[model samples]
Target: MTTLEDVLALVAIDSVSTNESALAKYVYEHLIVNSDLEVERIGDNVIARSVGLHSFRVLVAGHLDTVPGDVTASVIEGDVLHGLGACDMKGSLAGMIDLALDKTPRPVEVTWVFYAREEISRSQSGLLEIAELRPDLLVADVAVLAEPTGGRVEAGCQGTLRIKITLGGARAHTARPFTGRNAIHRLGDLLSFVALYQPREVQLEGVTYVEQLQAVSVEGGVAPNVVPDVASCVLNHRVAPDRTLDQAVQWLRDFLGELLDEQDVVEVKDWAPSASPELMNPHLTRLVEISGETPQAKVGWTDVATFREFGIPATNFGAGDPLRAHRSDEYVTTDEVNRFASVLGEWLRSTPNTSGTSI
Candidate 1:
């Protein structure tokens, strides 16, 4: 029966994703004090596990890292709790901790992973590092990521690829432009194409996942007085799971025909493909039933994809508006926090026990 006060108290400290040691220590201490869970740490990531009949394993995960932003003001309105990580995940983490503490006569074994480095690039995510060491430790029948879902189950995430498009040209003096081709000028038509291009919205596994391609950055101009020799634009593509990385690359090539040398269009980044929602699991189905909301697709990529790499299905379920997550006025409804916590507590209470028992 830990209160939101307990949750807010933790939030009061600045636990930006880059510096998660303090928060990890706090969570580690709290889990040790309130529950009979075995705790361990890898860098700043914290994991606490409790055994219950060893029938089936359930992993509850939430990143303790808050995106870098305002942390000086932590406020709680009538129903809203405002702070850096309030909605993006801290609320759900608090609820999970509360649920773990009230786990007397627990129904199923639960593992809590407060992984670090989730806000930045995936390569540095602590979850992935842990997966390499003890992959079986995270093996579970079901995993729920307490990422903000506005109380709905955000099944899975889309995959992303970042490509560098190099537009090559020879340099020449501005006064005698005929001597060399202007690489910057060559980029105009392609930029226009990108501006007017419409991304596709395809349906997968009964969910509509949208695809997007955009030029995130462009650089090549040498000087205003001279015709720039080489120009390059980095196109970041966020593709739906309907297409593989190969398909996505081919699609890009087709769209940007001859804009850059085919060989120069290299894939600078390749994340593992995304996983479709494991909505068919009975416990997950029951969770959706009790929450009384239809599930939806997550547009942005998340650590859930990292877990998917380990053959574990994951989903995002939590409270608060995701748009406000990294913004200055970040906030979450206290009521939403209370409701989400209660629903999780009830679901954990109802899990079946050993001897193939049903609660």
Candidate 2:
């Protein structure tokens, strides 16, 4: 019952953030009625699992929500599907759905997770709910998130830290500025440091991770005529997978050593741990070999970090150019869709859980 059109069909549904109620229903019904998998509805999330006590379990996951955009879509040249969510992830979801609908018996137990609110942050993510409420569902030997990776095997996403630094000074009228200190003036060193800071490139587990630090945003200035009393800047650090969240924080703080003594206030706004590579694992090694993909270090933060929390070896693999995600021209080739489904379907069917490890 699952065909190429399944991708197109999913692209048409508007699963924007927490508003994915409709799409959630469709996915639940699809798995229950069209596939032999045992399905469950946890809040707005849909999870399906295969029967039989297989030696190992594998999880296939994708988010249902997308950034706001035009949802209209269509098939193109019989090889392409275009519209919002086509590339950012709906295309992969369609492939996952097709895999779920397939009734063929497989060698390993499979679990499918269609989560919500991934377009935003992890706090609003449905995956967090599943993690907190149903940790049992996430137990798998190895997991795959069908994210937009252009059909490559991407591993070990970088960790992220967002810190807000504030400069405080005495507020005063511009006419008598000499009587008060200008907080804005103190921001120059920090801004200059960020602008000229050279990011380090570190190699971990044979994967080279190019780190990044940026002054992503600035805030403050009470009025045009008054000496600003408070000026704040937000810094985002993309740390290498080798560093944990606490380590990254200490690194950032050490970098701002004198500034801390200068009375600048620093607050950590967000911190997400990295998903270090598990290429050494037998299952992961076999997957990369079979897929013929050169393992690359994921530059951005991804849900792979979530699975990493539970010691699960997880990686990203799927169709659609990740660069094209969240764009108005987002699209995926039907040819790639078939290849995605086929590649994973075969991988799951043939790769038994013989690694002698369990989560």
Candidate 3:
């Protein structure tokens, strides 16, 4: 008999972004054969809902894929597990699987979603596809996204917009630099602005979301000996959730208006909206109480924003140090996974008649 630990150890399987077929199938098949839950598969995403007597449906979700890496999951000191996606969030997925196998009566209707390509972008994310394919499963009073939070309740997220800016100038041999205007120099000006620019911090719903502008990458000259004819840089802006995507883009353009003109191209390559704390909502409040933790703003863009767009209040809470996410040394403790499972499982098991917070 394969215990939940056996299944969790399957984190050893490689499920890099856009390659969640194996893991998705594993979750889909397990739900179908082992439980009476309503299970459905849409593309590489799996949706399973517990058939229980409850007024509110709690959505527990974790992404199925992680960035490319080949570290095999391994046990360390009988408590810690180290691997490519361990802290980046395979641990959260493991906890979800544990709850999915629970045989106890759930106080709230519970839905488990194993999504694909979350490490990609919101447009390609399986969560978005599931919303379009089956909005029925998306409906819930409140939701929890298992993003790495080191076990605290991280509410909401900052919106993100990646803009590609192109600067043009004449190309000439470095020996006669006076014959050409250096486009790379123009990029330097943009970098200077971003380097000195101060980020904004806004307090919303008892949490503060800090906004930032940063240059993630830069590309320019084909050869070192020649003055660059074109230079392009990708700048990512993380805006407070209070600002919409359109609002963030417009702000970016206006902020760079003096240096970048009509001829210079500035395009939004990607964007994702922010989620609100909705801290006062009963469901989120219950999670906070059960976890015995305070609220913090989720700085990174996450699926919590997807559920927020659907009018369902959402928050992020998971096991392990969030800072360890996506690193080569990614790891988590079995103790942490069990603690997460115990807290959330206890909340699910509490009946409406027992706790006013049941949902």
The RMSD of every model to the true structure, in order and in angstroms, is 2.9, 2.1, 3.2
- 1 against 2, candidate with superior lDDT: 2
Q: Which stretches of candidate 3 lie over 4 Å from their true place?
A: 1-8, 170-176, 222-229, 350-359
What would the TM-score be for candidate 3 when compared with the true structure? Answer: 0.89
lDDT of each: 0.77, 0.83, 0.82
45 Cα displacement, candidate 2 (Å):
0.7
Residue 169, model 3: Cα distance from true site in angstroms: 3.1
Model 3, range 45-102, lDDT digits (tens) per residue? Answer: 9999887677778889998898888746444545677777888787878788878877
The TM-scores of all predictions, comma-separated, are: 0.92, 0.93, 0.89
lDDT of 3: 0.82
In candidate 2, where is summed lDDT lowest over 10 consecutive residues?
350-359
What lDDT tens digits, residue by residue, belong to model 2 across residues 210-306? 8999999998899989999899999999989888778888888888767554667888999988888777777766667767778788888899989
Model 1 lDDT tens row, 1-359? 44557668768878887788899888888888754788788788888888656677778898988888877788877557777788777888888877776656666788889888898877788888678776656878677888888888877888888887777677899999999988888888778887887979877656677777788988888987989877878887888877888888888888877766643445565555666766665677677777788888887787777777766767778876667777888777767787788777677767643332221
In model 3, the clashing pairs are: none
RMSD of 2: 2.1
Ranking under TM-score, best-scoring first? 2, 1, 3
